[model samples]
Target: MAHPDARGNPCSSSSLPAREAAEQALWRLMSFYDTPLADLDAAMAADPAWALPHVMKAGFLLSLTEPTLAREADAHLSHARALARHATPRERAHLQAVQLVLEGRWHAACRVWDELLIEHPRDALALQWVQLWDFYRGDAHGLRARPARVLPAWDEADPLYAHVLALHAFGLEENNLYPQAEEAGRRALASNPRVPWAVHAVAHVMEMQGRFEEGSAWLRQHQAQWAEGNGFAGHLWWHKSLFRLEALDIKGVLRLVDAHLSGDALQITLQRVDAAALLWRLHLLGEDVSAHAAGVLADWALGEGCAGDYAFNDVHAVATMVAAGAHGQAEGWVARCAERALGAEDARRTNHLMAREVGLPLMRGLLAFSRGDADEAVDLIYPVRSGAQRFGGSHAQRDLIDQTLLAAAALGQRRALGRALVNERCMAKPVTPLTRHWLEKLALPEAAQA
Candidate 1:
């Protein structure tokens, strides 16, 4: 006889103990907490025929996106496909979604997960996976709205309901619904303070609204909640450093870098990106962070070892390499990214398009700016401004590209473009010190400020 999960979702395995253990492991994995992969291994050992463990493992590996992990994920996918005959229709649908991801059709995989949610709204794994892919695809509208579509199906009684609210809050924030997003995020945090995503959602709202002081205080107050064993600790610290930078606390920013963001840059792409981004922002502001950036590049083993196929990582690689004065490596990165973009299959053709279109120009621009060729940098980046969103990154992360443009415009003394861009920023973030300083430097008349 088949068993049911804790929330009563059907499992095809006859071994009830193994099924329950696998369910627990899945919950941990979906929660973004330190997942007990060994528990899943034990459950699979208990009953090798149980398909859910293999399916979950496949999903986890596919999400990692590292080339080695991709190979491991493929092995898991093959095993899951072999065991799909033993699973129920629902589990089979999940296997199909995993197959789509393995095939590089992530959006199609998301659609399958959406269908599964429509049928099994309580599938935490499906909801989390879909949200992750939405972020990776830079689908801001999908990130903000998809969870709301399925939220009515969940109740406060559900075990993972708060996490769903956190997802909704993040989506709302990304869609520019700051007030609603903040409320939902705070509610989720109040219910379960350990929800790092909820904490991150609130940070996004605060950051967007220019509530830098409030953002700093909130993150500092809640730091303990998200500090230990949380995979997102570095990112949360990165957000805090943004708040510090906005406050003109350069010392604080560097302190955060040394205290929190310091690590092996090559081991985890996220940490490397964070380190590079933090340093790049300082570099754009004309701070002397070449040594720090060089330290970051020391670990960046590019070419075959790195996951350069991810356009997001490719951009950061360019930023750090340029900052470290490794112009040759940056150029090589651009070329390799172009090759990968052109060579990608139809499923991820959009990523390839982004690489060929925006990624290449952005990297070349960075290289030019680093070499003090401000005019060349501006020339290369201006035409690609509208297409930056085609690559996968948040508004704040992508802001680095625009900042490069602004810096190049100013450095090249292209007063017209500099005036236009600075005024636009002023209108959007009227109280921002950086914008105000730029406006003053531009010597724009008082009426133009209004």
Candidate 2:
């Protein structure tokens, strides 16, 4: 007998309880809350033939992006494939999509999901999965536009409608649609205040608009809602730190780092990258945070075996090593990236090109800055500033590269370049004290100062 989920999509689980539990878990994953992996375990134990439960398990594991979890995803894939012979076409399509993900073909998997949605537009699982893959690939347009494509197919009565709205909110923000993004984010939160992604979307709006004090307060007011059992806690904290940095609240930023951002999240690659980024921001601003840098670098040292797999991680690893004064190791990581780019997969080859074209130069520039070669750093970083987004980070994260270039220009007394950059930044935001400070230091035209 064929089973269906709440939306009447074919599922392989005949057990009603198991199907409902798996559906709940999918919603939980979409909300960035801890999933019910144990429930799927129990469902599989009760009915080894239930394919959708295995699909959920495998999908969840693959989404983690932890190298160790990849093996577990493979095991689940084997089980799901064996049982898929008797499952419905929808279940089989999902199984195939997940298999592509397991094989490291992210874009291929996204295409599969896209086709699946064309027929079964209410498949929340596929909708969320594509959004996740889009984020990992840094597809800013896909982030906002994918959800927009499906807007006509969804209504407020749907169980996961708020999740879709939150996803759209983030996509809009990433695409630089701040006003509309905030409207969508607020709507999502009104539906469910616990939607951390919506909160994060609004945070991005405030961050980009230079609403530092308001951004800080927004996160703090909502901290209790998202602080527990949420996978994005560290990331939200990282956003808060950025707000503090902009406000020149060094102590507040350091406290957030010590109190929340620097612990277990370090074990996760993406979160660890956030930690490295925050610490690098502090280092760039001349804050003495050797202890924090040392701890983060030690964590990176432990994960050095996985270097060069992703250009994004490689650059963060370089930041960690450079901050710790491991100049040789930093260069070695860049060399490893060079080797990986040679025969990389189609999905990863773009990242490889990004590493070669922009990441390597930016990293070398950071390294030069660390070694007191500000002139060389400026010479290296200024040329490739426009291409930094190709390296697979958000606008906020890639801003680190530009910040390093500014640092080099300031230190090397490149007055003309520094004045122009400062003026550009000041014009973008109406009330940026930090940029104003730089303007004063440069003794540039007061008309350029905000």
Candidate 3:
């Protein structure tokens, strides 16, 4: 007998215990908690003939964006495929999507999930996976639109309703819909305070609006909920560090790095990305972060095998290398990225297009800035500044490019350009202390009044 999942979607599992175990794993995954894999293993052990657990396992591994894990993911997908004959249409669709993901076709996989959602609007697994890929692809429109499309079909009393609201909140925040985003995020927290993604979405709204103090207070207020035993703890700490950076509290940012962002804790690529981004920000502010950068660089283990697999990861790898003063390695990595982006075989991959159009230039610009070629940095980054979203990251993550370009303009003594960029930022948000400091550094006429 097929079991209906939490959302009443039929799952291809005859064993009730296996179905229950898979549901628990799905909850853990949707909540961003650790140990989903263990539950999944239990599910598979409960019923080796079930396909849903195998499909879920494959999706989880593929989402990590680690090339080395592809084979293991493929193995799981094969198990799911072998059981496809007994699977429901939804389960079969999931198998197809995982296969696409293993093929390095993320966009197509997302489409498969999209179609699945259209047919099964209550499929929380499909909703969560697609939202993550939308984020990874920098599809702000898809982020906001997809959730909006499926949200009406979700009942507020559903177990995963808060998670869906949190996803929508992030999408809204990413699209610059601050007020609506905050309202939705607060609503999610009101429903369930442990939703870290809701906490993260609200934080993005604060960061973008230059609510530095409020942002710090917000993260600190939710520290107990988001920090303990949560997979997103490192990223929440990174958000706290961003607030500290804006306040010019370099020491405080360093303290956060030491406490949460470094050492053995930096195990995953996401955590490493956050560490490198924080370190790179410090480096841009004229701070000597060589020691920390060296640690992050060492953990990156950059090699030909992983090169250009994901443009976002490649960009951060280069940032780590540059911050560590490994200019030679950084240059080589950039060259490799260029070669991969141009290679005929890789040209069909989505990441190749991202690398060629945005990632390569951003890497080159960061390298130029590190090498004291401010003019080259400005030239390389300025043209792509508006479309930096193409490279895939939140506005906060992409701000490093803006910061670098502004710094390049000021340091290179390009008066007109420097003033223009300064004014642009000032107009975007109220002049924070950091913006005032940049004005002073640029010797803008308004610096005296600021």
Candidate 4:
């Protein structure tokens, strides 16, 4: 009694009502909105023998990258594995992928999903999960390639087609294909105005292109659709703040921080990561953001036990602590990252390699920058700048590392390096007020002369 899901893939559920509920959850997951977990719970309760629902739930929880949710995700994985006898081959492959993620073999799980998609190209769940982990692992090439591979097999009229486009759009943007990325993202929005990821992709294109005013307007134009009833609202607001920062609208940026990025409203780690990044940027610009930094630090401190699980999270947590002036706490956080990198049990995980290679140095450099050891910060961070992608974040997010190095060069009176860095930035984007400010701070000549 197999049932076809929204994407026309055969699911194991026999009950119509259960299938409907699962479809609802799948839509929620695709849109990054509403309560997918509740819908998933209902689906599983209605058909206890169904394994796809359990796999779906497990995959969603694992995507959060929070160690506290790992146990819950594992429980769902166990349920899916126990019912493997009843699962379709596609479903069973999903079970194996989830198991690999649970075991901290993210790259392996991605490969499993790749194989599954080759067999069942319309599996929306597989497409979404693999794209997510690809982003998490900083495989920018895979981000674009994975979705591009299965997109031709997807019917244009399918409901999930637009979401697939959104995924591909993001991938293209990550790989620096700005024109193609924007085109794909707009096409997705044309199909479904409520697609946050499409909106996010377009936003990224504008952000990278230094179209600050247009980026601000674009986000605001779609704010009504993505600003509520979703988990991604805080991040959208954070993106808006970046536009504001570029315009040197310091007051406007602070207003957004107060209204949305305060880290006081939501307890999600991703939101807090945005908060730390925004606050840290302001700190770098010589603004007194100690109060906001302290609030973000408090939220991160509550999850202190999960510090070393992911290098990206660990770096953000350390950034918050450093920006908050918790020097001792920042040191301890770096120590934990070092410990995880060297520990026998953690050594086998993909994140351990990430920590050892890039995370530890970045965190230590940030701490040094905070402590006024500008030369030491420059020494530590300059070497890892090119490889920062290994720690897994968008180009905009990883720009923090470069920003720190530039500031360190200026502070340490490394005049030649400072001028070169400033020149590089000027060449990348049209010089804005912020660029001029940086130039002035470093006492460099105007953008043209530099």
Candidate 5:
């Protein structure tokens, strides 16, 4: 049994000096987002049981690193919950909220956000999450509505405002409203050079117009900016992955996945998990993800205590199994841990086929195309609606949904689908490089004419 702190929170380390340092680290994080995570990490290393720092650490991973480590971050969240200051219900709720995100519970995550928002209407992070949570629930109206309430109080001078604005732009872009989407994206990124989501939003502008080279070149240069010195959101690599695939340069996708995702943390962190999921999807698309990727996912699975989600984790689980080429092994794990893959619509459902349904179909569609089943490939494409940007992930991870469907149209030479996909992208920033390249295979005369 762990010792409790003065507030009766479960304590991880018995050392007074270490606990004191971690305490300071926690205060620092809440006060400013710019502190070196390395310092907080040092505090954690000294006393792993210190709950607040871990909560902040989870925030760091989600913001500054990969978005995938929600599970491992939840381990810290678990301790935070167990050790939470019961008197401070709001903070306790925040701990539970962090756990909810780790669990991939979109609705529950939203409920948590709503509760927090009701209590602290000015909580910017909660407001940002409300929109993102609505995104994953696949409700465009909800996505737009939440932000509308907050944008009045939100300042473009604040970087997070632009980050949130990027999501609004993405929803508009996804819904096929180009001019407004472009303007929103431009405003978001203009507020902060670090707003890659918005930058990618603008890149969508370039992509829709058929300037594949221009769009690709533009986002390519912005990669370092997104992955460094800002609150982390690197799943944009998934967007880039689609671009590389569009180019039909398998090596380009592989190298990018490797370069961006090659290294991972010792413990399963969110950043590493985020990297793993994207790269694993790429690996399934014929890139070689490192052999140890499966081992890493396994480690994350072992570090349980996450609450809320079945969609995100199940998606990653399927990707891990698919990437390892261990369907039989995965089926066994699925049977044992069978509760993870059910859809949100079913009360009894546990897991979701997010990767299997959206991401894997593309990989499988490519495989089917290779095997001369273009019709079947097209059949696998699903009608997609994003509930929240980070419900499963942001516009970046789910962009594959569009690319996959486009691949279907391109493969089958379905002129209507191809044109529709192009038109849809045209309303936003544009298609990403991956979709453009994929569409090129169909060789639309209009594309050439443009």
Candidate 6:
């Protein structure tokens, strides 16, 4: 996509409309995730000097599915950034935030996300920020609290308020308030049947209630519209990825990534909640997601001369450490958390956030399990105490927490922990092969006396 700003008659040469176009392009660009590259190309061809599109296209190229073509897009994005003095505020904000996320500057993104969340409380596009940044940092209490402050009239303001409902519901579920969570999710779906997060919550309720077929079937029914509309097709299965971790459709998840990650010079921006969650799924499935997503994630995590607060910034970092098997990195992440814990306004609040906020504490638990420190592992996530249903995260997201805890219980010889997790009290159904096999082999009579 290439264009020149030639709006004025050279004789009079007033760069007014050209400047206007640049400004318009920026907002359009920020709000324009998931639209196909070809269409964006057509837009650029219609007006070559549009700075925002070029900036966005370049961002997409960096995360391209295909190397050769993405390089071409990169050339154009480089050109767009070069011409950015003429870009609009919205375009600049998005481009900058996008860069932050890509760079993994968690602290920066944390500050920026809070501002954007407040500024665009109901922006259809700001949800992207909510995913990549805010999703990772805060706790369950944070997730469920003060949504009203963000959008007090949220229900009537945007068609996408269903998403907030989904968030609210998931937040409640993470805290073990299943009944409340289910109701929130159902209300969200009721308002907008298309809200994927709402559907995600309902699915969780179904899973806990043992309506597997019904839960499974809803995803199949809405997968297409949800994908095309949100650019986060994988999220449909993301919530279900928990109990069915063994039954996860790895190929399906990859296909969704493949469909979205095409390396066409212009990248299709998708919903942050959808795309980032899909990336996590891909990571869990043991795919080489890091290679393609590292830059894209870094772009979001780092932000441009600013900060953001999306939760996935931290989640993705931990997921990456897991994928890369970087033990030291995990330790450092904990060290950082410890630092944040010290200065945090409320330590209890932060811990509560950790319980469901991407389940990072759970990751620590798993890491402990890996090193044969089962008790430490279990202790790390003990706050995720059974029966505290408000551990608000997607069911699939919460599964990782369960997985780590179950493993820790068995290995640490915490029979009560093991039985509590595998038994019907915690999980509506009995243990699956993966959980059962792993737990049984942990040998509680052995090293674990805690």
Which candidate wins on lDDT?
Answer: 3
Please tell me which predicted candidate would have the highest TM-score against the true structure: 3
What local lDDT does model 1 show for residue 88? 84
Q: Is candidate 1 or candidate 3 better by TM-score?
A: 3
Q: What is the TM-score of each predicted model, taking all chains together?
A: 0.92, 0.92, 0.98, 0.97, 0.60, 0.52
> For residues 388-433, what per-residue lDDT tens digits would candidate 4 score against the true structure?
8888889888888877877787788676877887788877887777
lDDT of 5 by residue, 289-375 (tens): 546466556555432323123344444554555565656544444443334333334343212444334433443443454345666
lDDT of 1 at 97: 86
Q: Order of candidates by lDDT, top first?
A: 3, 4, 2, 1, 5, 6
RMSD of each: 2.4, 2.4, 1.2, 1.5, 7.8, 10.3
Q: In angstroms, how far off is 149's CA in candidate 3? A: 1.1
Candidate 3: tens digits of C-alpha lDDT, residues 1-450: 566887889887878788888888988888878858999999999999998898899899888888888789989888888888999988989999888877777799999999999999999899999998888889999899889999999999987899999999999999999999999999999999989999999999999999999999999999999798888999999999999998888889999999999998798888999999999888877899989989987776575578888888898889889889999999999998888888987455778888888999999998998899999999898888888787788999988887887788878957688898889888888788778878988888899876
Question: Where is the poorest 10-residue window by lDDT in model 4?
Answer: 298-307
Ten contiguous residues minimizing lDDT sum, candidate 5: 301-310
Q: Runs in model 5 with CA error above 4 Å?
A: 1-96, 99-105, 131-139, 155-176, 204-211, 220-224, 227-234, 237-241, 244-254, 263-391, 394-396, 399-450
Greater-lDDT candidate between 2 and 4: 4
lDDT of model 6 at position 224 = 59
C-alpha positional error of residue 227 in candidate 3 after TM-score superposition, expressed in Å: 0.8
lDDT of each: 0.78, 0.79, 0.88, 0.86, 0.54, 0.50
Cα displacement (angstroms), candidate 4, residue 7, comes to 2.4
Task: At residue 72, give the lDDT of candidate 6.
Answer: 71
